[model samples]
Target: MWRCPLGLLLLLSLAGHVALGAKQGRVRRELAPGLHLRGIRDAGGRYCQEQDLCCRGRADDCALPYLGAICYCDLFCNRTVSDCCPDFWDFCLGVPPPFPPIQGCMHGGRIYPVLGTYWDNCNRCWQAGNHSAFWGMTLDEGIRYRLGTIRPSSLVMNMHEIYTVLNPGEVLPTAFEASEKWPNLIHEPLDQGNCAGSWAFSTAAVASDRVSIHSLGHMTPVLSPQNLLSCDTHQQQGCRGGRLDGAWWFLRRRGVVSDHCYPFSGRERDEAGPAPPCMMHSRAMGRGKRQATARCPNSHVNNNDIYQVTPVYRLGSNDKEIMKELMENGPVQALMEVHEDFFLYKGGIYSHTPVSLGRPERYRRHGTHSVKITGWGEETLPDGRTLKYWTAANSWGPAWGERGHFRIVRGVNECDIESFVLGVWGRVGMEDMGHH
Candidate 1:
């Protein structure tokens, strides 16, 4: 009597089949490209074949969509010898690795030449939350709409609403600014993935922005979810799902995080560096590794029932209160992180073939989920000239669409763009002082 994961049953779809093995230890299965499963194995009716994750024989596995491997949480699980895979929640040693800017570029704010137009990452943008990513109107929808349903999916924020507010005449701007750039807004990035701190990330982004403007003073950047997660303070880990005030407390203690490297043992570890410049494979190597499957819910926060959002805002609409804080005080440039899935594009789209997220329902590629409000620009076109609305920022150079620079939208682009800002999970590392 196996029950499907709460979230997966509704939206999860099976992708390529994994080679089944003997019926015994935890079942093993591979996921689509880039979907790394950090805390579980795809044990679909397989048996005693004895496949292992991190092979440490203790904690569960944390599978990410990409990176072609899973992170193992052994030792913490206590059962040194077992057939069961470590549960996502039971195994609790989470962390954030160092992710310095690569090749003199920030994550979502890079200067690149696109369509013969050279765009500057920061030229017309405001850096909100400075280094962390943001959840604008659209992204929030993606999260609420699919958070429980989809894993490893990006939620780009929809900015059509943003435009409506900024330009009352329903006029579009060439670009918008970010909140961090706002005079007195709090510039805190939530301590996420460093410990599954998304709960903290979201809440803090909203709360901090609000409080910072209260008393016309800087927001209470003292939100620290880590304190709440501290087993010492409560029964939770210093790194579970993040929340607004809970995360605010955490960020007040520690700022932002990118949770990038530190290869966990027994998973697809390191790649030979001195790797060639980011060039498409002239000849594909052995079909590179696959994504991770088998997801387990984390129990650190207040529930095993993933913290569902209460109608805080009207579905896709931003809290007018918060938006007021965000808009007037913000126009900040949050990190522009493109998802790893963005690289999974197929042939006609560009030079590469569209790679699958491995699963049928999940997004095909990792695209941008973070957005920034750059400067508003008026363009002269037909119909007495029109204003193009959009934000500017960085996305990994790997993706297409808004991957290289802040993307311009006629307003409400598409799912990828919508999920881009508020699509929840994203990695944000600060830039070197001189780089921006």
Candidate 2:
């Protein structure tokens, strides 16, 4: 959903106005980042009469049409995913003066300014089908594309909570290691696509991170996207892949078994027989595609898709710089392939899924990633409205979110740090409980 960032034309226009003291009417407070700002008050006058910015992104007025404000989000700024979409960033591209917004604007490893509708790099292309498809999707689309609103309702309380988000095809790697001090400090094991269990995966990953912090007497659970897609404990599909509570129960009695050391298939259903004759490392399309609601196909292909190397260490003076700037800036961005199911979540947990206009199998690499920012927002939008936090771009997908993009809510969750989706919810929890 990192498709369209702030319009480039709008960014340039804002910068120019700020520099030139152009005039605008009924000026609002500071401009909302990632918004298209124009016709604002300048030092010389209340409003600038000349069209300072280009018209390449020329669509109908973006701000409320009749408001006659200097700026407005385009028609594509506030619609929902009712039907299939073609392509949405063409409006700004076709125009000459002001450029159109483009998708994947920030993926190629570059941090862009919060410009308005500026199309460049991987963002340039024909936007006919896309533009009209999102005729009124700027607002919601941005939220969908920017914010990774997906989540699970349940929570876990242990480091063993890891391992639920793998796909149905994989098994726990025998090479997996446990805490050196606590031999029984097992990680959670899970199934695939059963519980819409991103929370489980999150728990696992965070547990790992917290494990590193275990010496401090603390543990933080995280969702695991990998296990959800790979574990395959259940027959269901989508981002909601595994369960943490179930994982807890699985290990409660049995301790923890290796993915291959055990011979059981899946506890969910639709299995050919016993577990596919493969290990978590086997890659046999384990547990089917449960836990695969978020679309992040081929993301791991690029090492930079998830984990990123930091230039500064958090334990040193440079660490302060990281906390102040880099943490909020995040580490990476890209498109994750996921199922269309995520669309159901809007402005909430697992709400990042967007309507794919193409065949489901086609956008296998369509998930969005974000920068781990510590804090941001309370700024204005393109149409003179204000909101907190600007959703960073990811290759994932888009929704009718803020500024026609998805965003990361800074300073709220663990989003400020680099996040790796470990695995999703699986059926182990349900199976151990004797219910599905």
Candidate 3:
């Protein structure tokens, strides 16, 4: 006959009573009420193993008093509302536990139940429900929430013809940067924040550069994307998302005041909310020009003169033509398919990686984005591969990739960036030149 130590037997009986209390919807009674006891091993250490008191069947007496609660030693304990001691399976059943201890996943000092998720910027993360794994946002969710450029309608895409042609004999430079070529003329990259108004930001950036260059640096104004986001409401959705064609149309027809007059308010509102109300208005001048009728939105700045651009013209998908146009004029606007990995870009020539190929389709997602194609260059890899890239300015601010710029693999229509490239001339004239 096997007999247990008197103290050990008492603990076993107490553990059984605690388990019974738990099963009967009552608070588990404990001698040490203030002790912490959720983990596999408690402060006392190795209760079931040291006692060697595992029961062979569903024996009522087979239980262990853990730190402050009860854990069972019989097989029946694991069937429902598992209260088995950490070592019950190993010592009693001669097998490892089916799963690791049921401690919830910990993040930022908070415990999240299995399958709980949280978003970190554009990426979403979740705890593994049953396995020791983590997952991120689905591709569909990434496209829906993180990206905002709308695919152009066939009518809008074909409206403009290629506006520039390459000279057969004239040589094109191997590298070019708008900021370097025309110092102080190219506007610094601006942060769009979480707003999906790249349509407005890119259009405004390209217009700003072209206006300054066309005016010979005399009228270097940072044009307002907010003007476009709020006022260009005919066929646009403001920060929610918009089309470049519509944005350009608004810039040409109505015109926008400089950034000083109407500052950006897109960052202050919810990404899903409507853009701030149209704060600035304009009246048509005698010619195809207009004048702002409202005072500057920012009280400190008084200048409210409207800036306009010639109708935007598209460029052929040929890289040389795009480069030639950029060098001769200024930065041009281009549409691109932004993939999940694009958000993580830090630097270097970027090409869409196929890392998500084997993963589920939910993990592979992309959305259209508009950017300013500022320059172009070629990088020769150690393996003697020449990787041509476009130096594009993103609206994500100067802190992001390459000082607010990113180099993407050029030519081969990477990310459809070259598919629908566009350029425009600032509507600068003698009157505008005289004032500046």
Q: How many residue pairs clash in each candidate?
A: 97, 174, 0
For TM-score, the strongest prediction is 3
- lDDT tens per residue, model 3, 1-436: 2232331211111111222433432234222232122222332234467777755666545666553356666665665356666667777777866555444444454333221222322111111111111014344644654457899999978875675666678888888888899998988888886677888999999999999999998789999999998999988888778999888888898999999889887663365455589999988997899999999999999999998989989888788888888999999999999976676565667776544554456557688999999898887754555778899999877766777788988888989999999999999888778773
Worst 10 residues of 2 by lDDT: 303-312
**True-vs-predicted CA distance for residue 14, candidate 1, Å:** 28
Ranking by TM-score: 3, 1, 2
On lDDT, the candidate that comes out on top is: 3
Q: What is candidate 2's lDDT per residue for 1-436, written digit by digit as tens?
A: 1234543321222222222111222232123222232212112111112222222332432232111123332333323310001112222233222323333224234323221222332121211112222233343343333233232233321223222233466442211122232333323332322223333233333333333233232222223344333443443232323343333332221122222233222333333334332122221124321222232333332211111111211211122222232222222121132333322222311222222333234432333322222123344434554334323322222332222233432223323222322221222322223344
lDDT of 2 at 281: 27
State the TM-score for model 3: 0.68
In model 1, which runs have C-alpha deviations exceeding 4 angstroms? 1-174, 178-181, 184-194, 218-222, 225-312, 315-326, 329-339, 342-410, 416-436
Candidate lDDT values, in order: 0.27, 0.27, 0.71
Report the Cα lDDT for residue 275, model 3.
58
Q: Model 1 Cα RMSD, Å?
A: 23.6
Kindly give the stretch of ten consecutive residues in candidate 1 with the minimal lDDT sum. Answer: 260-269
